[model samples]
Target: MGKSTRNVKNSFITLSPSFFTHLLSVSPFSTPNKNPSPNLSLLFFLSLSILCTFSGICLLTFYPISRNSIPCSALSPSSPLSPFLLASLSSVLKDYSPNTRNYDEPDLSSSAMVPLPARGVAANPNISAEGRDFWKQPDDEGYRPCLDFSLGYRKASSRISKEKRKFLVVVVSGGLNQQRNQIIDAVVIARILEAALVVPVLQVNRIWGDESEFSDIFDLEHFKKTLQADVRIVSSLPSTHLVSKQSIENQIPYHVSPMWIRARFLHQLNEEGVLILKGLDSRLSKNLPLDLQKLRCKVAFHALRFASPIQDIGNRIAQRMWIEGPYIAVHLRLEKDVWVRTGCLTGLGDDYDRIIANERDSNPDFLTDKLNIAKSARRLAGLCPLTALEVARVLKGLGAPSNSRIYIAGGEPFGGKQAMQALMDEFPNIETKETLAREGELTPYMKRCSVLAAIDYIVSLSSDVFVPSHGGNMGRAMQGHRAYVGHRKYVKPNKRMMLPLLEDESVSEEEFRSGIKKLHKYSKGQPVLRNNKLDRDVLAYPVPECMCKR
Candidate 1:
């Protein structure tokens, strides 16, 4: 974790008056008691004074540094830049020292220990120094350092031996309110990488940012430490503009937050790699050109994990909403967590409006302009009208009882308490809760359930089947083995063609067409999704007997 050194400060022999005389025995000039020529005497005294000062400075600077210890000044709160200086001085001393300890001693016990700098890729010897200096940045007045009071020194000095130079897995969340599946996807990927996890604790602009959506599955305090270790940084909202208002920025204790800041920071993030599975449905996937498909794959494998859903949550929640004997988890997603917009309006303006328009189209009633249309369509298309009717139709076709209790868990499409009420109205027999009180724990209802993780699972398991609503990231995550459906032609085009609309406020039909030509071309036939099912290799667990029963 630190450089090794042999020169202990207390063990060094001090140069006393007797020692200075002894040193003169080995030098060209002998020590004189007094000089006769005044000019010559003055020049000799000046040279001696300069030599003593230089020697003292060199000895003092290198002594403690040679011991491979962070300097005392670096540990003090007042010294902001001393940590970097101390590390630099230690490196210099290590280079010049005669007796250096070999950290590379070959031992079977040290196999788990992090390796020293080998041939090409150098171990970051300065990570500790950088971390220490990061801690030294001014803490806000009212803000006590959230880090351990002893500072990051202890954790910074200790190295957890791993087989490779590990990378971190950061999850950039849109917000806590929406994108629970994306959060789950982030968690699944973290497990895959065997890396620590963190979320950007954010202030709410749209939904309650503090809402603990995935608390049932993960730990928060442990999450915070992961961020401190630079293993992960999950943000609720990604700001394109890096400028932070002075007052807001000053609140940061270590002056660190959501912004990883630049491409280099992203490049340096090897210890934590993200599997950002976005919500691209098969319908959209079919319409995308091979290049766009390649782009999606590149982002999935290369940059981060990009994924989309084969079915919407509205549909999934409906099919799996079992409130009685069989309790099921029905998670409804109301917002897009990862902003997938191409250009300017990706997060703002009229371009933003179109994005919202496309999202709202999941509700047929939303297409019809009622506030409850999204909710109505959500219920009708999912379970109550469509699924219920489909259940009756299936029962007629198969001859089984059509009586079963279902549970639905979700927020309103229009957003908040009012929307929940509309959903409750759709199915009076089913149990529904606007907000479950289970904080950081799974509810009792979810535990009792031998559940359908999604509608695709339900449809594959039971006789009731309906086409899924919109492209969903959660659905893709749940497709363990069952076949999936996508609306390639029905769903709108990829987000790339939408970029020009952001660049121009008023886009004409011809201009839009011309711009669309810039998009990577796709197979022009029926635009149906191909290979919509999950690749068997990607499942986290074996496909259970219940899932494959059909």
Candidate 2:
């Protein structure tokens, strides 16, 4: 070693003849120290620091200034800017960050754990019919022009005094959904007729074997108060009132018929002072006047809110789903009943046909619709519910990322593990009510099918993206609700295109993605949703009644 510089411990640091002078110029001990320059000592340390930095070693440079040096000891080297530098470096090395203080770990825990649906339960036909539109006609998809609801709510010419009694009775014979719709029809008709509606009698459908009454589920008092101004409502008929399975008289006057004539004629015919309107038929969704349609919106969206308890559970689950991030609620409705009735399996082998035949034989009453429907017509009308496997393929192909948190909202998805096997790989986290709530909590809702469906319906209304697998009662209801709550993203599947596309396994991943992208492009916004058909009711978020946009 040269006399000017020497090695310390086992390592040596070299400095050129002029390095000592340069090191002193930049060193904290710039002023001459009482103990001398200590130039060689500072030079060795500075060189060591430079060498260690290039080798990826983050050496702590803030060791206190040397005691023997005056200027070095006078100044403290620590500064506020050093933390910023440390944070930047720590961000690059997040996985290996020394502590959590440097960063806020993203709160994805709730979304990471989705409420799981109870799979493999065959007894639960009580499942929500989320994505099934059982009522679409061939012309259901025809063009729908924009409506000017701004002026749609003009006062009707027939607003008679509430003191007049236009007493009416209705028979609710269908299951939950069909009857729910029928009630809306009845209320709208009663309002039209300026009638005092008797609390409707819910007949026990022998097929279901349940004897639940309307008061068992619906808030009867709320229903009365909600429609109070429009129509006077009572819960039951007097002993003198006659009951009939069929309409007591056929010609109920429509809006085009003079209201005065309807009031006078109906009162004249029913000498008993009450019109017993039987057979649940829908008039609210038909070609009604603008004022009535707006009124229907009011009844459906505003007045028909579920009891707070059902809404509470649904909101809690929804909040959990959204806590980590927003998620999609996929209306998965490929139950056994939907499968056989739709005849969507026509082209598949006899195994499917035999399976369908067996179901039909076991339950002759299951296939309610007697229409001679062709598979093509069913395809065009989107009658068929997609199987779980088909859904998985569609979702994967749609470019939904693996991290997507989806809730499967419906009854037991058909085919179980075999069907969901593909979807599990694509979306590892899929949950349901069984996963979210305890069995004890759901027991009360078991017999209340419509309320159970309403729970799912409420969750769906608050979803980031609602993908209905079949066009069913619950699906349509929530789709309408979503529109009312600012049209948050409702994706109506074009089953005509999706079914055929999924069976082709020959397609590459790129091709699959592109196909899904094109298919879903239609469902992203207001075009399909805005174009409300004569039958379907989601018109660009509820125009005048549900949403005022203020």
Candidate 3:
């Protein structure tokens, strides 16, 4: 699924010389003189040199770059064939001569085939002159799910009853993870209020910059089937539930995730039979009771499922993992956006201010109180995922076999190639959704992070061992999901201990391995989890207690 540089280099080797041969053959210098005429040859050489000066300009007219193309060095101003004194072009008479180069498809390939400036975007096309143009992502063996699953949803066909006024909680929120946690709260809230729960309106998250519907990313049918017994959900507010526009003008404004929202208040404080709720952000964990936490397991692990195409892709990847002996599905949380949201600046020099400033401007709806949280506190609270280096060390310390096939699931990391250098060296068998699925297959996901994350979630859930670099939304969700799916082992790094160990000069490779094993022994397959603190310490899959045997 990726273009190899070897092919491009071989193509260039075949063409660079022939083009030069054609150039010299059409010139006066192509003829051999019986008697060497210094003056004549000098005059001919000077004229040819003058023509070569503007060769790059003329070439651009023939090979116009639509997106962008790396410039060919043959026509460059500094090229030896261009009559310029190029120190790097030492073999001017042989390699860089007009008589030596002959690249085919000159009409299509730019002079450099990269580094060429585009119409709008600034570029130094030569930047890729020495390296491959694109990253190679490979496909994995196809496999089906362990069990048949259907991502289905049923349409709501009823309006609120006029005779009865049940509490209909309207949760206006955005973001996938935040909304998910709030849904857990909403379910419990609906139960407490003895109200008919309206199907959550999964509005497009401004922060996520996506236009997907709840149904587009998830199997609402599965969600409904799982939670139908505990709470009722509808697609929209019933026709009878709406109030006149005049009534809305005087309604109380939604307080967001109102920490004080109680079931008793549902009936006691309804304004004209409709309550408007907004800012239902879910950073706090105390709103839901123990029973609600158990319900969260049902909602998050069992009720939620990915849309069909994504699940299929994940299943195929999971099957590869199953066949390939074992694999580590790592949640590589190195996206620039998440770093900006956390305002962490350990190694991200000048990018720190820019990222934070961009987030503040783009996401103005953020909880203002969360802005001042310290970086250490964020890490402690599992808000920050490990940096590429930290994750590498932790995995290495955990004695992960270097030959293990690691599936990297998440967004494009921040440091790019520079960041992945060490981690990739340690484990070369890393794979991603892009490498495992074809473009047409991925078309259904539409390049959305949430959709891709669903694929990551499924793959990680079924992996031989799941490793989360951070305790972020995906990590927490997968850890819990893997739990419900029969206690698959999950590797939770003891970051507090591991970081210090990584810094110590006395610690050997063998010692690091021992520590990692010791740290994670109780972290996986435990029976008591759905406690949110599972992010911070050793508590695990709540399946045994929460889910009864089928």
Candidate 4:
């Protein structure tokens, strides 16, 4: 240690030679014990107080300060700022570590627990179809365009009129031409929704539908006078066709609002107060309402009193009307390319010359090689199956036996003709289109065949499987049929994705067999089963073919 300094404990604190000299020079008890010079005594005492205060502060800063212990910085030896800073810092540290005061250990019992809601069945399909559509087609995607309704209402709300109300049904006729059967269904749904106040406005291509037939259903003359309580059908200039939006609006009548029409027409209506009845743009089967109660309610509330099902119109023809029997309603779509390239009945890559040559060269017994080619070749195979001739031949050969009648519904007239001839040739007892068309239209045929009921079995080629088409109404209709049938084995192919063209190339027979196995397993032993919870949730009560049941 230095002569004038020493280590006390672990700290080296020094009393320098100069510090002692200065202390001695200004000592109050030295000499006559007179008070030293005022300046010198003040400086000496201040310096001594500071040295002691600093040493205390160093100790306090490094260690925790208790409430009772006043930090040296807070209570400065000769000033007030030190005490203030110390007090502020002490409060800051205390507040920062408030948990330090927590004496008891944390209760671990409640830490791992998660609260769950006490609610009925976690999934319910009985909710509104509007909500379902919204969930399926999110807002981020323009599937359901975010309509700006701020000018009208801040928050969109569903409104149900207590008394009677007026509803506008906009029929959007775009994309592929809707099957006549499908159109009628859409119309019926619209009438069901509005009851007596539903007005139908058909917006189709300039040259799409038959105006006379449309007018007969809508009846514009009677509607003008208000004598007709049924839906008023009108054909306005399409908004999409016109370049100007305002121009399109100007063309529409005052009675019909294009906004309401478009909303209902595009299936984009969100059930904001007014209910919109979307017409047949796409297949209703494929995009069926997940919430069926909402669908039924919407239909019941909006449809007109005298609205007719499209099937009725088709069935009205003077055909042998079999209500429920054994039959097959075959639908063969006259695919555009199939007709243009193949010359209607002839197969693809064959023309009139090729047909005539084939007919002449083929065996006398099989003189109709051209006819056979026509029936066999297809534009969109799997989508619409082969002609009735081919289907009947295959079915008969497979041993469908006697009483089976194949009613060809849509497609080329020649295809239907060929099928009728084949059925007549194979099973003379079999009923022809003339015989069945004499009975009724598509629906009656469908009903008779037990296709839509609990049938013993549904055996067909690759095309006719569950949900008809991929993400199409065909699939949905199949589900509906299965549900209606109670519980049945839907004997369909397993992995064979039944596509339109390239049927042989796209899916293998093995895959089709696998799918059939899976479908059979699901169906169990019943002729039908109601498995689609989405459909059952909403369509539990008033089932289709209700009349046939009672």
TM-score of each: 0.28, 0.63, 0.61, 0.35
Q: Which numbered prediction scores highest in lDDT against the true structure? A: 2
User: Looking at candidate 3, what is the lDDT of residue 27?
Assistant: 55
lDDT of each: 0.28, 0.54, 0.52, 0.31
lDDT of 4 by residue, 1-550 (tens): 2565542332335344566556555655445345546586686687678568657756844443221111222222233333223222232122223322222222111111111111121144553442222112101110100011121111111122111333333444421223222343444334334322234444443322323233433323333222112222333323422223211112222223223434443342233213334434332332233222222222221221111332233333212323322233333333333333333343333454365345445534423114444433432322233443444433332233444444433323433444356556765544333343433444432422211111111211111112111112233333333332221112222222222212444555455434433333432212221243323322222232110121
lDDT of 2 by residue, 370-434 (tens): 35777667665667777666677676665555666788787665555555566677788887776
Each model's total of backbone clashes: 21, 14, 35, 47
Question: Candidate 4: lDDT of 51?
Answer: 63
Which parts of model 3 are misplaced by more than 4 Å?
A: 1-169, 172-175, 245-260, 268-271, 283-291, 346-384, 529-550
Which has the greatest TM-score?
A: 2
lDDT of each residue in 420-491, candidate 3, tens digit only: 667888888878877777667777665465677676766776565677776665666666555443345567
Q: Report the C-alpha lDDT of model 1 over 1-550, residue by residue, as the tens digit.
A: 1354344232334334444545454343655545434455556566577568657766764542312221222222333433223222232122222332223321111111010110111243533432222112121121110111122322322332121233332323432212333343333333333333445222222322333233322334333332232223343323322224311111212212123222223443352332222331121212222222222221121122111121232233333342122222233333232221211112224654466557645433323223443333433333211122222222122211223233342223323333244334433444333232225222432431111132223222221111122224333323211121111111112333333442465876455544543441331112222334433222211122111111
Candidate 2 Cα lDDT to native: 0.54
RMSD of each: 23.8, 25.9, 27.6, 28.4
